[model samples]
Target chain A: MHLVGLQAENFRNFSTVQLSFAKHTNLITGSNGSGKSNLIELIYYALFSRSFKTSEDMNLLHWKESYLRTQIEFQRDGVDKTVVVSFNSNKEKKVLLNNIPEKFSVLFRESSVIVFSPSTSQLVKGLPSVRRKWLDRILVRVDREFTSILYSYQQTLRNRNALIKRKLIQKEDYDLYDLLTTNLVSLSSLIRKGRQDLIKMINAVISPTVSKMDLPMFSSIELKYYHSRMMEDPSLLAKEEIKRGGTLIGAHLDQIEIFHGDASVRDFSSEGEQKLISFCLKLCEFDLIQVKTKNSPVCLIDDLFSELDEDRAQLLFKYVSSVSQTIFTDLTGRLIEADKVIPLTREENTICLP
Target chain B: MYEFTPSYLKAVEELHQLPGIGPKSAEKLAASFLKMKQEDFHGFVEALQELREKVKQCSRCYNLAESELCLICSDPERDQTKLCVVEESKDLVAIEKTGAYNGLYHVLQGVLKPIEGIQSNKIRLKELFHRLQHESFQEIILATNFNYEGELTAMYIVKELKNSSLTISRLASGLPMGSDIEFADQLTLKNAFRGREKFSEEMI
Candidate 1:
């Protein structure tokens, strides 16, 4: 997949900007605070209809502006499609695919993107919740049934928690509890299996990439699934869950631990090593998405030059340029060899540097 | 605000109280009523008045009825050993229109919604349990909506009748008859896949 064009209005520091992209590699060079990251963010938002940086949509709006709008035109499977995302100060957001309104789930099924930003290191260093979310995002995109299964599991968990909170399970309520737990067990098993399968596929792609990178600290990186024991014996957990007055176990408590040799990368790896692992994981993500969807995803690398050392950056650029369409930002304005180069300047607002 | 007469404003206000009829729609309905012939207008009002005065809940199944028992419960040709439970009388009518079900019905009047302060006791579940105890049903079908509250209510009924020897089932949820699979929502498609039936060579 490749992005053909992007248009934005009142989005972050870019008041109004329209630009086309190359099918292979596009280098966005700009000074500090020149809205380079914002451009990449707009591309991400157009695909997902949500910002990766912040949960609040208002933060994407330009200062003194009440609304932000962005449109992205991309080609997938030899067909052109447009995605438009608009948000106002009232927190109302609208997403349109090919001028027709759509839910985020449907949009995600059609488009896929792998982002490597400054915060990408969080996958290795952040809490277990982050890794679980990452795994779920990828799994949901790859399998459509997984979305509904996950949704049902979440709803069942909420209802079960509510029932437990009542603390008065009537004779009749026992059956309800059993029904809910049965659903939770089955759904969690499906989710656990989906994540496990995704991790396996990702590991298959990532192991060689990590090894090929010749990073000594992470010569043998592995992605492992850590699930709650309740998945195997839900009945046992049910007894403890009633005493705890909440659900004691499920995929919600699961994690994806990244291991480097004998220890967790989060505990032992250096910052640069963590970043490299994250980069490898994203490359695996790009490959997995392509293999699953049969369409390569647009890769967005923000501040790539600053994020990696010269050798690592060159390796990443070489890999992405050969396999997928990539757009990366550089602040030094150094001429990076690419199919297209977009130089941005920051005055009161961002503009294309002549 | 004072452009219309008092009776016209009152008519509009009453029309607006109907579900899904906003203030603008209420005005439009009232204007259409005004444009109707005098006899037709009186007939419409009389029909509504008759509905309120004559329509009563079926004593046996709590469905809408004009007599002691609902039409389905009283029909001699309908299956007496099968009972289909629904959340509302409108659902009974919808099923009846499909011409697919010839079994009796028991309207719960509403689903069990604890969050909305609607407990099992608040609805007609007591009557349902009483009927279940007295009636010798071979099978009971839970035809509730495919939603969280409906599922909860159905589960509660199943639990209540756990000791009974009757076969119990739920309405199969799937894509509508004319909908394309590509257009069906994920939940609907998933349910359809879950409830799919195996085909046999003899049936073919």
Candidate 2:
């Protein structure tokens, strides 16, 4: 499934927009700060209900505005569908599918997207949690059980912690503990499996993308999970819990190390290299998800053109175009392929800007 | 700061504060209350107030019970030899719904989360292990929701119970990974039961 058109109102700086899309490649062009990133942010919000740039909802609703709204039109299996989503500080967010109220998950079923943005620079060079999260999100998209497991894991952690704080020693708490461990072991085993499979997938794609881009071989682009959990008694990690004041064992604390051959990429890589590594990972994601879901994701390559030089821009475009429908945004017209440009315009009063 | 009549408007304001209750829902609820006869409204208020006071946690299993022990714990016909442990009364309800396992139950008042400053000394771990020491149960079934924190809690209990003579086994493969038995489909629950396998004889 792919987003074919987008509409926005009081969403970030856009205030108003109605842009057409291309089947293979669509280019969004404008000056810097003229709502290019805002447009991409709107698409991300409409799809994921979160922003890559900012966590604060106030900033996204436009200055002094109380609400933000986005509407995206997508095509799936030859059927055109409309999904409208909006939120106000005063109310719960609302979603409508083709004018009918529907569950939020319904807004994204089988609808896949692979996105690359400046914030993604941290995927390779930042923290373990970032890479782990990147791993889980992709797995969750194709594997519903992973998402549910993660949700339960988070909630169980909260509930378990509450018991610890209250010092409430009811017999049932032990029973709960038993339940928690059994689930954690089973789910973590699966998560470990998914990651193992993902690492192999990443290994398979990263090299080819690097070769295709003609960039220096990133021997540093390696994903190494702290492999101790597989060997160490998970119970030992549990024993450490008394000292750590929580469950110190398993995937929650296990760190995944990334390297460019012998050098620690986290310390040695340039920001541009980090971006390249992250972009390569996103492409790897597209390949893996496509293989699993059998559908090319709607690719949203946001502002990568502004960050890369002409050579990198051409390479990035070349790679992104090989799979999926992509809508890329650029500040200067240079990023716009002469043959494929979709201008953003609003009539006198379609969706007025804040 | 906004002007409002005490009787009608205050109720509307308060009702609107509840989640999923927008201004329209708040107005509707308040209006529904007003439409109720005085006797009916009194009955509703009394029922709401006593909802928690009436039902209490079972002393044996921690499931909400009208009496000292819940139906599951109090049932003499149950196989005391098998114990299915869970994290909440909700989990107990889930297991009970299947009607496939005729066993006893123990509910952990909560799970273990150190980040929130929770410790094992606080929950029902000691009580559970203490019971296992005296009871000649054949097996302890770990049926907790599968997730990161739940796994830690489950492992700790299994480790503690390792000293006991009872067989320690986790509920099986078919419950669909990462979900609570409460949310598991009936087929999956049946499969989990059918797939039940021992963790290790050494633990027992």
Best by TM-score: 1
Score each candidate by Cα lDDT.
0.84, 0.72
Chain A accuracy of model 2 expressed as TM-score? 0.86
lDDT (tens digit, per residue) of candidate 2 on B1-204 = 885568999899999999999899998999899899999999999997888788898887777898999998888999989988898988888777889899899888787665565556666777788778778788999887775557667777876666667788876558555779887755457667887767998767
In model 1, the Cα lDDT at residue A278 comes to 89
Q: Which TM-score values does chain B get in all models?
A: 0.89, 0.73
Q: What is the DockQ of candidate 1?
A: 0.33
- Residue B128, model 2: lDDT of 85
Candidate 1, A1-354: lDDT as tens digits = 888888888988888878889889999877897888988888888788988998988888899999988898988888999999899999988989999998876788878888999999998999999999898998888888888788878878887787677653564455567777777888899998999988888777775676555565554788998877654455566667778879887889987899987898999888988888888887778777788888888889999878888888888888877888989999874646888888888784644332
lDDT of 1 at B17: 100
Candidate 1 ranges beyond 4 A from true positions: A64-66, A229-245, A348-354, B1-56, B111-126, B147-162, B173-204
Candidate 2, after superposition: displacement of residue B22 in Å? Answer: 7.5
Cα lDDT tens digits for candidate 2, A185-251: 6666777787778787787777766766677577337777774345255446444554455654456
Model-by-model DockQ, in order? 0.33, 0.14
Cα lDDT of model 1 by residue, B1-204, tens digit: 449999999999999999999999999999999899999999999999999998998999999899988787889998989999999999999999999888899999998764444566679888988888898789999999878789878988887888999899999988887889998877788889999989978766
